[model samples]
Target: MTTYSRRAPRTLLLALSAAAVASTLSAVPAATAATAVPTLTWEPCASTGGPTDQECAELPVPLDYRYPGGRQLTLAVSRLRSDRPEARRGTLLVIAGGPGSSGVQRLTQKAAALRKEMKGAYDIVSLDPRGVGGSTTASCGLDEGDRDLVTLRSWPAPDGGIADNLARSRRVADACARNGGAVLRSFTTANEVRDIDRFRQALGEEKLSAWGISYGTYVGAVYAQKFPRHTDRWVLDSSGDPDPSRVARGWLANMSAGADSRFPDFAAWAADPAREDAGLRLARRPEDVRAVVLGLAAELDRRPKASDRPGRPLTGNRLRQALQGALYSDSAFPQVARLIQQAQDPAATPVLTPDIAGALSDQVAAVTMGVVCNDVRWPAAPASSYARAVAADRVRYPLTAGMPVNVTPCAFWKGAPVEKPTRITGRGPSNILMVQSLRDPSTPYFGALRMREALGDRARLVTVEHGGHGVYLGNGNACGDREVTRFLTTGVRPGRDTYCAD
Candidate 1:
């Protein structure tokens, strides 16, 4: 579920020595060298289609680095081998976005595109981060209402109150503490990085080149920082701020600017005459589209519309939630605009997408909450501060309604981070290339600039002047895609920051 915003597994600790791993490493061979390949056992696993090529394998890793022979958890792994073995350069790991997102499914969805682009240049691989889809799981067993996206995201009240948010955050935090097990306790970025190294060892790659997107960019950056020598060619797409101190908290907060940056694109699309016949045109002018949306949201706040569904009328929060969803992609903008048009017209009926304001699985919410909670501490006064922020944000960027800076369970998250969050310094190998959209609704240009500054001489940034979450292969921009493709294939990056005009 890619919301306008923003998984915890076991805290498996591994102290990876770059030289030692490179010398005769257990997981991967040294960079620029080939070694004996370790055997990988592939077996069927879980997905929408019952018996796909999905496979499961275990990577034995120390539970605690201090106690090397301690207990271990089997990390579920999946792979899609390249079609052309002769052209295969190496294994390119697809690091999933959410700390809670499934890497296996991502591999399946993007395999064709990756294979087509690279042309048997690499075997695509991914793993379910602990406590995520198909991985070893944990549960908070939250009630249905608490798991709803509107409630879970801690959106301010229609009337601008946050009392419900305060109560919900505390209640959800308590539920997780009581019901979530040790596996839930282990969900942290440091542990995920450790598990990745162990998986690298299990795969028998000397150095792992990776394509990390969204939240995965942070994970990739940490991996690069922790094990600089283990990297081959790293690609971070639609990246967020890499301020390790705030981690996921900062990423969540960044949605404010992200949505602001992206909404104009949607506005222009909704205002286009091309959308008139589609019944998706919200207004005649681009600015009018924004006004109509905000006005409708405000009107819904005052008097919610009765929908085809029984009690689920289009409410203010519902409209806001829809806006959040629409900002993700161009394809979705029309649907959201249609939702608005239907709500405005009494005779018309709007088809509500189940995802707009539904309850995510208790498990999904838990993992989403756990990772942010466990990674870093947020101020407990989020509700109070958020109310103020939302009011200010509504004035500053009315498109998002200040939900981006609002509160969440992290404010009341029970667990403390096990290890220090990795600050992505420029001290690593200079082999990293970042491809970012200038107007990404989720990871805005401001945050990406922070990452660019942090990476210093280690990275070359290719800025795609587009409007979307992902730049490469997402927005219809040849310049951005070519820059990334060239870098991934030939190991050549732009001499400096380059712009790709849409």
Candidate 2:
């Protein structure tokens, strides 16, 4: 889930007055008072073999909303205008997953599919949040070892010991405090929401429709809560619980259940007769696949296997982390199965997932840690509390190996949340629709139901009887995709909660 890269100005005259007033407001510093809706000078984006029509621009937003006039950070924004302008009704924002994902890249990746589906009904757009690709960035100056996917995820030792985890957590926290300045501190869900509003103003549109996936769902939900009047038709895919008290902490803890729910799908796939010919089948029965995977992990725990990467062996934790990554989609099952097969052979060298093989870039690590650590304060309880949690979690959910409940840098984070997390409520417009898989490895269906509950009467949920982290255009579920497309194109939602069979 933390793969990091997994991934306005309507009434011109009145708008001018609003900008003038905002500049002079006592809350804004005098040195940097400027129009809130700066005109965007869009130009053709540098060719990256993506959609030829895609255009890019830079939007300057305050690094700190509390001091809007003090400093500025530029957000990288991109758009693919409607081919049929006559059919266009509004702008649709595409929100990418991951607190560190590049919205600009996501736009490029999805532009063609979205364009084909929407059929020029709207000009699709997205913006890289601060500290992402093509945007202003900050670093925590972390050691390469600390930034590795396995280490950043806080996976425990072979015997389930967390002593190493505790030390790393404290060290990461101290490094962030010393090296990550206000820029890192500026990364939070609240700040991101504010940035969206600023982007809306710059777009010169009265409202925006959106398709927010994964963690983007949380960002979209907060935006709807803060600026209900500015939303037209909002779609949240692969949503998680919107419990403000827990926030990212709750999402992480819920992964244990999510992985359990989703693993069966992978197990079934691995056991299928079709995989036998490819030498990918792991077992004779669906139930047997679980034992095969678990047994392999335990064996690795006892004696790690050398991998394709020199000096970077495949340990139990690395395998577990790889499984977690693969569970996000059915398409990845073969890779995980192959890794499993290779691990079982003494002479075979397993190929590591790129993420598990090396360290994350400092900017990527900074934003991922910044948002989760800054959004809410993790419990600063004694290490024993975390040890107990990890121990219990391991027994309860072996697939995750207690990593979900393990202590992280958040517990020792130097910065406190600048503002309270936004509580998503039903008070907003009933223009929101959520699409979720029944068994999401990153965001379980049970957790998504919590988000459905929090939104109350204002939202409609289209549950897909499928297994994966994303729904809607993802997973190839015609039923689910139709429901979302109908809502976006026609603004017509199912009168009650609905289900889509796989």
Candidate 3:
């Protein structure tokens, strides 16, 4: 994930300038903090079907480090104690994907799988970042329609005009300024790293092990950089380019290339003879799948197919959304192809999953926007500048069209960044291990190579010659999974970059 450095001066002309000014005044460098241990109280985890061994706790962190004794927000945390105390090495924190994904929920979902693999080697734990899940949250107070995922993702107009994008960007940024409070401002990557250190202190662990995915990889890298001594085994999965200059902005822009690299895997699967047996085939030939999809998208662009939902239809945007969703996992390939097959036939109707259309609540959107916008400043000159980039992007990356490079709320965000973005270098410990899919849709291979370069000899990368995101355990690539597990459990890493062929 890319983010702008919060180091600029706040000026009325630019929203990010104010944010930068605020960050500068309130900034407390993570490494310079006084070494103070935090007291933690554990209670039974709260959820509809929470496990018997699961427990929850709240860690109080200052909203503004400058005013350490001022207002505090609670970070919702959960843990699954190590089953084998004799074998327990330390706490393993699961840093979740998506600036918006809930870490607590991820811990709950992956606890069993982790337990089976780690075999009581460490306590599995995670926390919902501030402004997510059960944690203290801030809202942009966006209207219901604008809060929808489709709108937030910046899907182009039916004719491919980006007028709506520019308007929405300004409107959303304004809402965040008026409604989002200090809690939202404090939700930067640097702050998350600081909070992780606080959690480490609270847990009484001399060193913390972690498995961070997607956006989490950048966070984990920052933690390892900021608190090198406190790190145990660190695993960064499906990482975006950790370019400090552009930060999350670069990650978003790179999606154009990432989608292009990973789309062929989807195309091949959609056209395979095996898909005919599943009744999910979109094309008789692999090469035809792209044209078929582009044609269908154009048709949808002209006239959307009605879905079961009253007002919602399967538009070009929805198709793009489904495609983006499907690209995340190989298991989702058939589902997207099926949607295409259904949309292609006049008699058949497409089904929309609740998980697909739901926009995060106002709080979730706020944090997602806050982290990306806060970490980096996006170009806000004019809609035409984005339009030019979008038009070029659409020609090169038809799978994603221009959504990834389009203007977002961050373009009109309220102030410059408040702190310098963490530049990941080889200066940290050599304990970090990265695993990536060569053709990952979200975090592409070329960008991962840059991360490999940035880490220098401080880290080693295991590249899985496969498609999709989250290589280890997500895709059925046993080689990558086993290698990562061995490294985390036994502290043995491949001496150099290695590839796992499918």
Q: List TM-score per model, in order.
A: 0.89, 0.95, 0.92
**Model 1 agreement with the true structure over 181-221: per-residue lDDT tens digits:** 77777777777887787677666555788999888988898
lDDT (tens digit, per residue) of candidate 3 on 342-441: 8998999888755455556898889989999998777776878899888888888888889898889998999888888988899978988999998988
Q: Which scores higher on lDDT, 1 or 3?
A: 3
Clashing pairs counted in every model:
10, 3, 25
Q: Relative to the unseen true structure, what is the Cα RMSD of model 2?
A: 4.7
Each candidate's root-mean-square deviation in Å?
6.8, 4.7, 7.4
Clashes of 3: 25
Please list the residue runs of candidate 1 whose C-alpha ends up more than 4 Å from where it truly belongs after superposition: 1-39, 44-68, 308-311
Candidate 3: RMSD to truth: 7.4
**lDDT (tens digit, per residue) of candidate 2 on 233-256:** 999999999999999999999999
Arrange candidates by TM-score, highest first: which order?
2, 3, 1
Order candidates by lDDT, high to low: 2, 3, 1
lDDT value for model 1: 0.76
For model 2, the superposed segments whose C-alpha errors exceed 4 Å read: 1-34, 46-49
Q: Which structure is stronger by TM-score: 1 or 2? A: 2
lDDT of 2 at 146: 91
Q: In angstroms, how far off is 189's CA in candidate 3?
A: 0.6
Using TM-score as the measure, the top candidate is 2
